[model samples]
Target: MSLMTTLMLAGGLLLLNGAAAPAETRVDLALVLAVDASFSMEPDEQDLQRHGFAEAFQSPEVHRAIRQGMLGRIAVIYVEWAGAFDQEIIVPWTVIEQPADGPAFAERLLRNPVHRMGYTSISGVIDFGIQQLRHSGLQADRQVIDISGDGANNTGRTVTLARDEALAHDVTINGLPIMLKRPSSLWDIEDLDLYFRDCVIGGPGAFLVPVREKAQFVEAIKAKIIREITDRSNPRSLIQPAHDALPTNCLAGELRRHQPTAR
Candidate 1:
């Protein structure tokens, strides 16, 4: 059977199995947190990236965030991506319906090995998240793609096209921009926040925040996610407003024809 067919059959079984039980299968709020693990993310930085998330789900804030969602539950996936084919789903779809379930899920995430890949294809990673959700089953109140990256679109598909595709289908794209030192290669892009705004974010009430430093990554990730799950009109925490900048890419003119996502 095709993957889609298998997923459908498996979901049917799960529904039947839970039907006789007292409680309903947990609400299916799905969040795809795509982390950038490109060459730019040094090993220690990557460890910090992983640790920040592990710590967040275990935090009181995240637990409270989960409870405040549409049905007091959400399922999440963690993927680390770099290059055109560097996508790896470190954690599969797991439900967090209670306080206890949250921490345990976070522990499983902590054990995954972090591999350093060399190129940064932000759109490649977004595409992977979109595909994962297609097989995720239509059992959720919302679908989200949260991406954290440190650079502009230097490879693979153009960032705007990817954002439009994701947002076109109501899949909100929130961004955590890891802006480090600028290199000659990313000349026109003065700040990653701009790249994320014009190219990486969309959907209902989409937002972007900056992980200004390694230490800030933990808090940034936690705060951003909490607001997302809670449907906060504005992030209760600080977030950088979008900074519009013309695509500084030398070949941007030729790529603009890629078309906005028609999803």
Candidate 2:
């Protein structure tokens, strides 16, 4: 069967055979995990990040969050960002409604090979995310772009320019700022949180969560997922597909939409 057909079957199966999720959900939130693959982040930091997301998807909190959403599921995609044009979609939209669905997705995410494209272009990821969200088939009240990175946007149209454009369309964008030990070289960035707060993150009720240490990555991911899944301030933001990435799918591919323009 086609992937889309499989997804329909999966959603139907989950609703009939799987545990219950919410109904009439307005938001079809898709987390565009905009990660930083810049040269500054060390190998250990990268592993911590990758594993953190994997672990979060497996957590009970995430499961609870999905169950709490009006639609009880969410579609998600992952991207690694560095240069203005260096963004690569590492994961495609997969819905997770049942408890088992979340863990399965997480496992797949854990196994997906790394993409090494490097640049620090937060705006590039946002632009790419806009395209993904626009092309994703589900319709809802809110569109979210969860951008996580360790540096300011030194590339692409100025970060604020891109962010403002997204906000204008009523899209909510959250931020995850990674603050590891400063690098001894140019790749290392300081004041990352401030930079993200001032230039990178924005949207209705947009917020930035700081990853204070490498060890805290997993916890941070869990917290973010909980907030994304459970919060109803933007009832339209609740996703109904279910889980974020666990085991990444190679079948995930970009759709045919004009990319989000960098304003």
Candidate 3:
């Protein structure tokens, strides 16, 4: 064979071999980090929330948890949500398989500008998170939606409806109720943690890490992420559990809006 022909055949073989190799990476879990960006959050609060996540992803504890996973890796995506139609994917799906991947994930998180808009639609973001999991491409033993919000669902169809849908699909939903202070508006509920426990989170191993103070945001987020990465079943061990069987008005947000205010 001529020299040129021999080289061409070798190159073609190499290309074919590369194409046949599997490109997908397996992980222990697939997580969607859904942050609430409703108008209730002040600009500084938004920044604090974003930074808290960034710091958590960079923390040694979280990285350690990732490495301890069965596959030693996990796929995560960051999303910001507001009204029923205002869900945005801040960071696309990324796999973290090593310590180095943690900082890279943190960098991407901090580089993006935090957005705030519309009303608080917990149901909308849960639906969006489910969609993301379906299209993540990465195979995982566990699928989770880490939803953090300060208020109740006021604009969406219903939070319970969405939560049930996700649970039915075998996707676990965890909550981070930001109850740093009193309800900002009538639509906001005083028992945000109870709302999360009874209505927002579902599926096996579902739990919440409530942030009751601004100073606790970072530590709370870090602990939550670690627990998630490790697939811990009992989150109450990490944080205080909400009151059991507490009556929560899931439709409180809508009710307040429709009812006439007493003069």
Q: Give the winner by lDDT.
A: 3
lDDT of each: 0.72, 0.65, 0.80
Candidate 1 local lDDT, 1-263, one digit each (tens):
67953654333221221122122345646788899888777788788888988998899989888887668878787888888778877766667776787787688788879978866777788888888776664366788999987766556877677778887777989888887555434222456676676677888878888877777888888888887888677635345446434463533322332336310
Task: Give one digit per residue, the lDDT tens place, for model 3 in 94-186.
Answer: 777767777887887788888888888889988888877775555779999999998888887889999999999999999999887787556
Best by TM-score: 3
Q: How far in Å is the alpha carbon of 190 misplaced in model 1?
A: 2.2
lDDT of 3: 0.80
Return the TM-score for each candidate structure. 0.80, 0.76, 0.86
TM-score of structure candidate 1: 0.80
| Residue 6 local lDDT, model 1 | 60
* 1 against 2, candidate with superior TM-score: 1
Candidate 3: TM-score? 0.86
**Candidate 3: regions farther than 4 A off:** 1-24, 235-246, 260-263
Estimate, for each residue in 119-237, the C-alpha lDDT of model 2 and write its tens digit: 56777777877876665554555678888876666556666778888888777888888876664444444455655666666776777788877777888878776776664454343
